[model samples]
Target: MNLKNNIETILGRPLTSDELNNINQFKNQFSIDEDDPLIVVLALVGANKILIEEMPKLLQQKANETIDLHRQTLITQSALIAKDLIHVVASSIDSSKSPIQRATPYLISFFLGGLSLAIALVLVR
Candidate 1:
């Protein structure tokens, strides 16, 4: 996705040769792995004063939103992992195995349950 081309298309006009050259140079200089390329391009354009100064604010908002989404996802995943751990613990405890086998499973499940609790606590924060 070429940023300049997208901008030009949005404006419904072809950019001048100088603008194209600048955009090309900027693209080479600005290297980042971003989900949304428009944000980075907008920041660069803002730096050159070719776009509004509010670009950074938009970028900040997007970053905050992304962070929030990831946080929620992590918490949800933690809960799921905890649920699975509990299930494993329950099944192991219910098994009709020898006393020694049951003892080991109980000990393992106790530690795993503790780990799951830690993950849940961390995700909550």
Candidate 2:
């Protein structure tokens, strides 16, 4: 009943050989890519939200564990979105590389605001 391990398991695809070795060797697993990891992490997070609602008894006595799980998922998801925006903002600032450079910040702000609203709705329900 280790929730963190269960969350890691339900993420579906396996990590790379080096990643597995690093994990086994107690090495820190830094993020390798941007979009895919964010998508996968967020998707897993969304699925977890569904599970919490559907299986209420899974959280009865373990209230603190449930809260911790939710908090960790939220923090990971937020960090992923931040990482995604970093690439856009970095490349967009080069006028020659991206004509829409100035718009990226606005896009990121809008996305973050929307995500916040979505999270509020999810939690309130």
Candidate 3:
């Protein structure tokens, strides 16, 4: 059919091998074995009409901005869950006694120093 050449001309580019093959495959809307040129042209015309009419609606449906609220809700929920998990993890970590308490003699020395200084100050007063 001259439709192939016409499409190429409208596109201002030569049809590639893959494009030509696809056009041939989809040339017959129902059966590829059918050789009725008029049927093929009519089918192509009908398909083009459908695309022209439905593409905008389909595209808008897919890219609609109305889902922003749902997306924002999901993000807010996930962030809240993450914040809760962080608090739980931090509390659990802080509750555990570490070996550093025994490993570091500085803690005991600092405590004794503070007590001695307090006692000295009280005795002086």
Cα lDDT of model 2 by residue, 1-125, tens digit: 32234345774544446544533333224443333344455445644654566476756648977777887777667666666665655555645545466677657766775676567547634
Candidate 1, 15-124: lDDT as tens digits: 67876776667656765333456645654553455445447998999999998888888777876787777677768574687788778776786678778767766866
lDDT of 1 at 48: 54
Taking all chains together, each candidate's TM-score versus the true structure is 0.43, 0.30, 0.31
Tens-place lDDT digits, model 3, residues 6-104: 556555667668666666666655554444566446445644654576589988887765565556555555555555544544444432457675334
- Provide the lowest-lDDT 10-residue window in model 2: 26-35
Candidate 2 residue 116 Cα shift, in angstroms, is 9.4
Q: Global lDDT of each model?
A: 0.67, 0.55, 0.55
Q: What is the number of residue pairs that collide in model 1?
A: 0
Candidate 1 ranges with C-alpha deviation above 4 Å: 1-50, 95-125
- Note the clash tally of each candidate: 0, 0, 0
